[model samples]
Target chain A: MKRYFQNKSLLNLVFTFLGGVLLLFIIAPLAGMYLNTSFNSVHNAVGSEEVQASVWLSLWTSMAGTILFSFFAIPLAYLLARKNFPFKSLVNGIVDIPIIIPHSAAGIAVLGIITRDSFLGRAGELFGIKFVGNPAGIILAMAFVSIPFLINAARDGFAAVPERLEKIALTLDASPTRVFFTISLPLAWRSILSGFILMWARGMSEFGAVIIIAYNPKTAPVLIFERFTSYGLKYSVPVAVVFVTVCLIIFVTLRLIKKKN
Target chain B: MLVVDNISLKAGNFELKNINFRVDKGDYFVILGISGVGKSLLLESIAGLTKISSGEIILRGRKISDEKIQRRNISIVYQDADLFPHLTVFENIAYPLHSRKEKNIKEKVLTAAEQTGIADKLERIPETLSGGEYQRVALARSLASGNDIFLLDEPLSSLDSKSKNELRVLLRKLNRNGITIIHVTHDYEEAVSLANKIGIMEKGEIVHVASPEEIFKHPKSEFVAQFIGIKNFLRGELKALRESDLKEFSIDGIKIFSLTDAGDGEAFLLIQPDEISISNSVESGSARNHFKGKITDIARAKIGIEVTVDIGCELISLISIDAMNSLELKIGKEVWINFKASSCKIYN
Candidate 1:
């Protein structure tokens, strides 16, 4: 250790130390939340009605958002991976805009475009799908902010498929539609699943966006924030810890499935 | 019959221009070239994998140039096999036939797999198959499809020598069974052994088309000569000695004869490296042209040693290992090289 510190290449060592310090600093809050929990508080929170509602809403919305992501994002990802067209770069760049924007700004932008007065919002009114204070708005808000991860991951998976294999299928008289379903889609299914997991988790954890878009629906993140504001960290901590722990379990299970495949 | 009529295709930086050739039914036509000479591109264009920029692909006198690859009835095997990784070897061979809803799919797949000797490994995934095994699977897949036109893009390139030889025999057998094979390869020996008709491609153009024997004996141009492994060449003036009405010429300031009647100025002296014989002392024989030269180098060729003999400041003759041992030829040893006048061909 003394020799390592004395060496001139210790500059790299210094940077690595600083990075580890930063990682620990970032991880401290989550660690504290998990470590600070008492058995009584957890038991009480598990029995509470508001905590139950928040946990239920989180499960419902994340599942709905993931289903939406699979249907809407898979085709777009396939197109991005397999085809070259006009404005391809522009389209890909625009899809990733939500990933870089502030969550609050994304929520506001989504609200602006999706509120009752807007064209899409008015169109949705025909189908009785209201944005403000609704489960639909919660799902929409979560999906809007979390979709880029799914799209990009699935796109990479699809891109990794060799084009010749698809052509070989074509030569074998498999139609283009058949080829996509049989050859291209199966090869990229693992990436798409991982993307689905990411999108679901991100959507579940969304706080600022869900709060701005539809706070009344009270997904887990908003419930935690509301419980923190009205009843303090003592009241909200158990639910937050539970939600995170459940999400971790789901993430791990998805990862295991991915590995097996 | 497969007729590639005036087909031109551009793939990024390389372009196959005005490509015209015919592979008769049951012909093992090999496209021979160096890497990146657009041989693979040409085969792909013919297969409808790549769109032809111009011209018609006539198969059985039907213009199928604009047809989609699926409808073209062509099967292709790549160097890497490009087998569907998720599918088992059995499933992969069964894939094309199953997709077509062909009757007797299982029997076809098994027969093809048996022919390639990969029937036992049928249930294994592509990743589990070795290079040669994967290629055999690919070949089995193509054979199972029963497409008369087989586009092989150096399918045997990755195999070890023994497998390559075995596959060559298999390909020949397949060809004899009425598969019109357009084999693209960078290997000259593969081309020589396999091709009934060889098309030497250079810079995207089919420079020469001839039988294996004709190509080996008398290549048409410097490009064809070099591409076909003719390693001995000399730049010389074809001194047009106008004798009566008979116009004859000799190259390299050496008095030579020609069966190919010619009147020439500047020319390239071409000879098969194996045609020249080396001996310790010159003897009177059937060979007319003789030159005394010192051995410059000896390198191992497949069946024989390639001995390079330096004659004066000009000619270098490459002789065989058998000839070397018989004459006790070594580097710096003085030897007389002889070739029949018919062996020396002048290309201007």
Candidate 2:
């Protein structure tokens, strides 16, 4: 080991040092946030009914949004990967628009379609559900802001699969639909699942969009903001710590499962 | 039986024009061409993977040009195998069965695996298999579909020589089991070994189609002759017509005889390297044509030595290394090259 490093040039040492600094820059803030909070505050925050409800709302609504949106997003991804049509690049650019634009602007875009006067809002009213200040509105806002991750990731996954494999499947008497579901989808599942986790996490942490669309049924991010404004950092820091800890545990477990498979 | 009738297709900037062919049932038809010559495109168009601009593909007496790929009951194996990475070998082979909703899936999959000698690796995935094993699994998958027509696009090109030989035997075995095959390959040896009928494609056109023996021995075009490794192409004009369908031609004032009944006009003559024999002495028997030339070049061929003799024009001959040693053949050495009249093929 000593000889290995001794053979390195000074330029290599400088590059290594810069990369180490970037790694530390990412880890330091999260480590500081977790270490500064006391265990008693984290425990008390977890036990609070309103905090528990907000965490539950964030978890289920984001999961619901990801699951519901995947049906459409995955097929669109397959089409983008396999087909050649007019305005294809425009459609691809439109998929990325949600990711690049501000979350507040995304929220307003969802608002225009779901407002009471619009046809979609009237349709929701016919189903006895109001979008303004409701869980439905929150789910819609979460899905709107986070769906591009799923689409782009799944599209890349499908693109990586060999076109000949799908053609071979079709020649083997499998229909195009069967070929997609059996061959393309299963091969691309790893990317699709990672996309699912990313979209779900992004929805869980969404603040500006959820605040604009629905504020009554407070998600974890909205509740944390409300606590910071109403009380001091003393009240908000515990909730933030609790939410971050839970997210860390869940994300690590998911990544471990992904690795095992 | 299958027929590709007057097929014309435009793919990007490449255009295949008026391609026509027929493959009888149980025939191992090989399309031989160099790369970028629309061989794979032709196979894909036949399997309905690529659309043809104007054509009718007939299979078993029915026109199938407009049919969907799934309804065509044709199976193709690509060069890379293209096996599904997510599935185990068993699942990959059994995939078509699931699509067909067939009964006895286990029995069918096992039969195909056993036939391809891959039954032991059924539980493994494609990523873990060797190149030969991956191709065997792909072949098993195609065979499991119970399709009669098998289209292979350079399937053995990626394997090592030992593996390629093994798969070649396996493909021959599959052909013996009553499967009509349309194989596309750039390797002349593969085409000669597997094909009963060979089609030579050049620049997106089927330039010549004939039996393997006829193609190698009597190429009708200069391209076919050169592509098949026939090194001696002498452009000559017909000078006389002898009895028993024999004709004489002269090239650069040197006369040659060919056993063809072609008319008295401009003609091209082709002679394969193996058809010529080299002798140290000028004593020749039944061979009708003989020329004394000095050895100009000698190179190591795949099987033996390739000797180029200059008899006004360069003529190549393949002789065994032992023969070379016995004759003590060397550069600037004078030797006699003898060939029969039937050996020289003439085309007008």
User: Candidate 1 chain B, which ten residues in sequence have the lowest lDDT sum?
Assistant: B244-253
Q: Which pairs of residues clash in candidate 2, taking residues 3 or more apart in a chain or in different chains?
A: none
lDDT of 1 by residue, A1-261 (tens): 888767857888898999999999989998998889997888887888887888889877877987976798999999999899999999899989989999999999889988889998999999988888888888888999989989999999999999999999888778898889889999988888888888888888888888998889788889889889999989889988878877888889888888987
True contacts kept of each: 0.78, 0.91
Q: Interface RMSD, all models, one decimal each? A: 0.9, 0.9
- Chain A TM-score by candidate, in order: 0.90, 0.94
lDDT of 2 by residue, B1-348 (tens): 999999999998677889999999899999999999999999999999899999899999999999998888888888885898889999999999999999999999999999999999999999999999999999999999999899999998999989988898899899999999999999977876678899999999998898776787678888887677857766669856645567788988788877775557876677888999999887558788899999999999879999999999888999999999999999999999999889987654
TM-score of chain A of 2: 0.94
> lDDT: which candidate is best?
2
Q: Which candidate is the best by DockQ?
A: 2
- DockQ, per model, reads 0.55, 0.63
lDDT values, one for every candidate: 0.82, 0.90
lDDT of 2 by residue, A59-115 (tens): 999999999999999999999998999999999999999889999998998999999
Task: Give per-residue lDDT, candidate 1, residue A148.
Answer: 93
